[model samples]
Target: MTQKKSPQGGTFKKFIVVMVIILIIALGFTGLNYYLKYFGPNVTGKQEYLYIHTGASFNDVFKTIKDEGIVKDSTTFYWSAQNMNYVNRVKPGRYHLHEGMSNRKLINMLASGTQEPVTLSFHDLRQKEQFAGFVAKKIEPDSASIIHLLDSAAYLQQYGFTPDNVYTMFLPNSYQLYWNTTPEKFFKRMYANYEKFWTPARKAKAAAINLDPIKVSILASLVDAEALHDDEMPTIAGLYLNRLNKGMKLESDPTVIFAENDFTIHRVLTRYLSINSPYNTYLHTGLPPGPIMMPSVNAVNAVLDYQKNDYIYMCAKEDFSGYHNFATNIADHLANAHKYQQALNERNIKR
Candidate 1:
């Protein structure tokens, strides 16, 4: 239908159409971004500190980004992150992050976590003091920083070392943490594992024996020090358990060495027995001040589930294979000890 039209009205109508097209394109981009933030797979990005830490929330993550000056408007960022679909994929612990990453980029990085690395392990630590030293070497961390943080005096002992809480720590399994983990965080992670390991069932078993798990660990450490093989560990543990139940002295040479701080075990004199230290099992009546060394789990488990037998004493014969002779009475033990001493004198070569 032909109709009369003004030139100005015609130009304005064309301009309105162009404005509508531009608005449609802008809305499409916004919707696409929303989809990407929520439903996009394999979200990934690089980060500097490489960790998220414990007790951190989504808001904390958003704040970290804001404080880094990666985003200009925090309100917009917080709202976007809150509305994102993939936000639940964020994990706890350390993560690698990138500088100046957009909200879209950060979400992807968390969802696709190829960034977290395994934290290093502390191996063969004997005492709490050694654990601190171990952290410095294993983590290449500032030793001075963690030294005072993990005092064995606080963590390992209360009444004495024998009554200490060494078993409070759990053995390591597969765990995901940042490589540059701090000493406090490392202790917390380890303590958490420790608590998990001491389940109620295990605690009940320890109570049945009238032995604190930590005390059992103390004995386990002695067995660990005495044994050269894992096979004889249970028998060794059984001997200690039997002795404890009988109200007899342990008289272990390792306890003596623990008191002396000297590692040489080849030679022992009557004077050594007279060494004035509570750790000397020969002089004292019970288990020495906690674990003399960081015993293996096998050693600890062996002590926890020791065989209930009549044997009250154990002494290794000429063989250094860690096997021991078990006896029901002190007379039998003295005889075995005599034989063991003769064998020891015959093969007196120090390595």
Candidate 2:
């Protein structure tokens, strides 16, 4: 014996079931929205880069991201960053952004302080200040700060270098490093590389030639300045070595130009040679006090493996080619110099 339901009660039961279904759908929709907002991709555009400067606040980081239009939704990104505690962990560096990166991914990267390394390379740097300035352009530290460290005598003495010869510590090459490296770290890294470059074989070769590493670098710089072509570096190195062995003045034109502090002088004059600077090889009978320019690795090696020859003098060829004519005697050298001088006169290079 079953009892029949009333119309009003049945309608009430139907209304209750409808309300429950509506609530379930609403809950599911809200959960999906939350998931999409937090875990889904919120960044927009093709690949891009972002630079977060040191000491930048969270607001600055957000503003930079917003201005660059890197995110698809700002509110979602802000919420995610706050929730992940990235707002307090902003790191300074250069970062590469990929297309369609999620906010979570981006925030994690910023929070971790992971940065792409900067490609740092320097060559033919004429002065310490110039090298510092060049490095400053690529890193966080200013040129003055780097120059200050380089000029510190006590600081350099710790590294077996004087303020004058510290320039030799940096080898000319491309290096990968973080953009925020400090001055001290930069010098230490360069010195480490320099040490690695002076292998046992190279040291032994230097010893055989009676030249220390510093002296070899000094002579290498002269060879580097004189050789316009890589193929001729060995011969130039040999000629200078001969001059050093025979107790003759190096009389390098580059040294005279260096002593005069005039790189613009294409032709070294007798007046420039009289400069009293220790760098004037015309007056000094041996290597200059320090390198005139950053010697390339090839130049450094050329001195270690200098060609065996009796030549004691070299002058630029009269044909205006980059090659030089070698001479073993004073008479032949004078003739070569005369021919070069005549060619210079014809070209009216009268500096």
Candidate 3:
């Protein structure tokens, strides 16, 4: 009204205003779509982990995610992954899933190969097969693969280990490792840990006791098997060491059971002792060729720092209290053995 604008000018101004409003609406819609596709919550809370195995293709990963219902929207995740260049960066691992993770966050984690570690702990595993089976359950390698490496004499020679003695390298403790670790890497890590455990002081102690690290572990396995209670480990270790020093047989019942390869034998009989095997401590004068079982840290330390005692024989107490009666003379040892045998008879634990 102030300038007496023409009708044509007024029409042009309205058209321009309309066009600007349409452009603004379109821009806002695009922005919202972009945010939803990239930063919106996409991962679900149903799954705890998404295992992307090694040598998996992008298609495999996507299929697993969809099949496991790991993500809320498969299309949005694929879109975001493609746009963020994550499709070509597939990494294999055990990835931890969180509730309500954004597509960008999840994609970035996967692309960068950030994965959770597996906590592995083992103890008292009897044989390499059992150990391999237990470890196979924790890691990516199969039990057969692990056993192959454990039995490979040529491969173990590089580590200064044999098929028999290689079992000693795996110390019983909790370890942090990647779930996809190969069998070779597992052995390397275990050997490194074994080296760390056998410190200079421990080696000196072993040498002073006229035993090497491997021999200490072998003896420790016996001590670990014989002692039902931790407090009696040093005493049992000392008794065996005394026998070793005197050139007498170890005569360990556990060794006899091990030689027989029958763990169900509650009471080792005379026939079990006569089994012709190197592990039969009754027949073999020195320590067995290898550890009969995985020795505990306490058992290993007990062997290294054995108690000073003249006791050369040990028999389980007749009270079945998991303690032993130790003796230096054969007569007293026979009496202890007889009492224990009578107790076993009363309990009807034959064979």
lDDT values of the candidates? 0.67, 0.89, 0.93
Best by TM-score: 3
Candidate 2 matches the true fold with a TM-score of: 0.92
Model 2 spans > 4 angstroms off: 1-4, 11-15, 45-47
Candidate 1: what lDDT?
A: 0.67
In candidate 2, position 285 carries an lDDT of: 88
What tens digits encode model 1's per-residue C-alpha lDDT throughout 131-250?
666555544246776755544566434323322444325353455556556766766777677677778887887788888777777788888887877877888888787778778898
Q: Give the TM-score of each candidate.
A: 0.62, 0.92, 0.97
Best candidate according to lDDT: 3
lDDT measured at residue 295 in model 1 versus the true structure, 0 to 100 = 71
**Weakest 10 consecutive residues of candidate 2 by summed lDDT:** 39-48
How many clashing pairs per prediction, in order?
21, 0, 0
What lDDT, from 0 to 1, does candidate 3 have? 0.93
Summarize candidate 2's per-residue lDDT along 1-351 as a digit string, tens digits: 998989999999999999999999999998987778777887786436788887999999999888888898888899889999998898898888877788888888889988889999999988888899999999888999999988999999988888778888889999998888888889888999999999999999999999988889988999999999988999999989888888999999998888888889989878888899999998988888889988989999999989999998889999988999999898999999999999999999998
Better model by lDDT: candidate 2 vs candidate 3: 3
